[model samples]
Target: MKASLRLQDTAIRYFLEVAQIGSISEASVRLNVAPSAISRQISSLEDILGAVLFERQPRGMKLSAAGEMLAAYARKNALESARVVAEIDALNGIEKGHINIACSEGFAMDFIPRTLSNFRQQHPGIHFNLKVCAPAEVATLISRGDADIGITLSLSPTKDIKVEYRQPSPIMAVFHPTHPLAHKKTVSLSQLQPYPIALPEENTTVRQLFDICCSRLNLLFEPILESNHMASLSRFTAFGGGIHLSGEISMRHQIATEELIAVPIRDRGMDVRNIEIQTLSGRTLPNIIKVFLAYLIVKMKHEETIGF
Candidate 1:
């Protein structure tokens, strides 16, 4: 059979819903299909695709490797179909729907709130489910269809995830106002050598970037404290124990509150990973997600241009 003929819409949808819910019974409930119907459709889909989609477990079904690939394709196709319908609806001037997004805690706390608040005001009928997680976890959530959108620092792309937006945000040194280095408008990596530093834990992207930069400058970067959480890092910096490095946006509120001073590390060329907005490749975002992404792109561009 032809590849197109092998995958029917009903089968594809059943597979997609099952993948989303991670259980045949739950998918049946969500899609309003009988459990047997869902199972039969998924089995037919597996046969057509020439791969098993799920493995039975005592509690729930788990996706097999083949299932993951097919699920990604199914999600992309469903999203595209919805986008087409939304476009048709737009001709009648009716805007609607919800968007589920997964993002890192840093962006969730500072950047996303303002942008989403603005989006909600403009499209009150649209709903948002924002899940805050680490960058790797955010990527996994999007891959599993638990989230429609993801915002995170640039990393190696997963098989079908597309990087839609990448905004460069600088990593700046933060210190309490009373700290000696806080008086300097710009500091070099060498200037920080004398002070104890609070840094992200070793495996994180931020810590890796900081390590690479310091190594290039032949500067010693021994941290007195380390944490995976940005909030904790900021608190440590604010308490006057040690300096910390963080994204400019993540520390905006604390800086405004005068709890800490942010100094640009001019000589070290302190640039953090490119902030990215990602979606499954070949997919169309829902109207709410599409609009929110457009808004985010605009806001990030504005911030980039204005040096925020």
Candidate 2:
């Protein structure tokens, strides 16, 4: 018996590059092949797969329905290939595989670095690709299969994905150490009313929680400064500008090093939100991810029990 030759791998790789670049010519340039040769390969792929992979457009080529399906399969194959290569590299005691992660700016800045540093030390051959986006954007990236894992706060678990809830982190009100309310161990919602609050824009989980808390206390809760970035809020709060609200895990270092104080809000009943680890449903996690997630869970548990 003779072994079978397969163009599936080759075709999928070619189309992945083409889809990424959106132009056969550009893909050829990147692939170091002639434009005509790339075109021939695409045509051959289409014939072999018995479906058209791209729709010609005046600007460039777009993936057709069948093309989209193939592209998805190709992406999964690419990830699996990287995983296999990483496993092979691990035999040499090197961690040389790529992991793409999506997280919010706060987590990326404060938490992920230490975790990744430890992960890197343990698996020196692993490469990391990180994107810092809003929680909703992170969710979208995970759903679209662009990210292998997502970490976010206050996210409602959805059936579209599998979610592992980490320990909840308290959302606290932060102010400059010298501020009037800084002396208090806990602050009421009415006490926050005297100061201008700098908060994330409307529709964010943090903002929504803030609003509900304010409404319950019959406070207006108008923000003097609105931003999407938590770091900006931290900066503003550090300077004695206004009160800013964030998770205790996110503000731990800032509170310690920047002369900022975090007072827990008691009256409004704002509960801690669980930071979630999310992935596409039914997808088997690579060993690297499994190890990393285990580490994350352990670390989060420690953080939850110990004040940061």
Tens digits of per-residue lDDT for model 2 on 31-61?
A: 8888887788789888777888999998888
- The residue pairs found clashing in candidate 2 are 95-125, 95-126, 96-125, 96-126
Give a tens-digit lDDT track for model 1, residues 1-308: 67666788888878877776788889888998899998898888777777788998888898899887777777666667777887777777877776888988788767888888887788887778999887777777776667888988764656668888887766788889999889797888888889999998765667777888888888887789988788888887777789998777787677778888888887544674678888876676766577778888898888778766
Alpha carbon RMSD to native, model 2: 4.4
Estimated TM-score for each candidate? 0.77, 0.75
Please report, as a residue range, the 10-residue window in candidate 2 with the lowest summed lDDT: 1-10
Evaluate all candidate structures by whole-model CA lDDT and list the values in order: 0.79, 0.77
* Candidate 1 global TM-score: 0.77
How high is the lDDT of residue 71 in model 2?
68
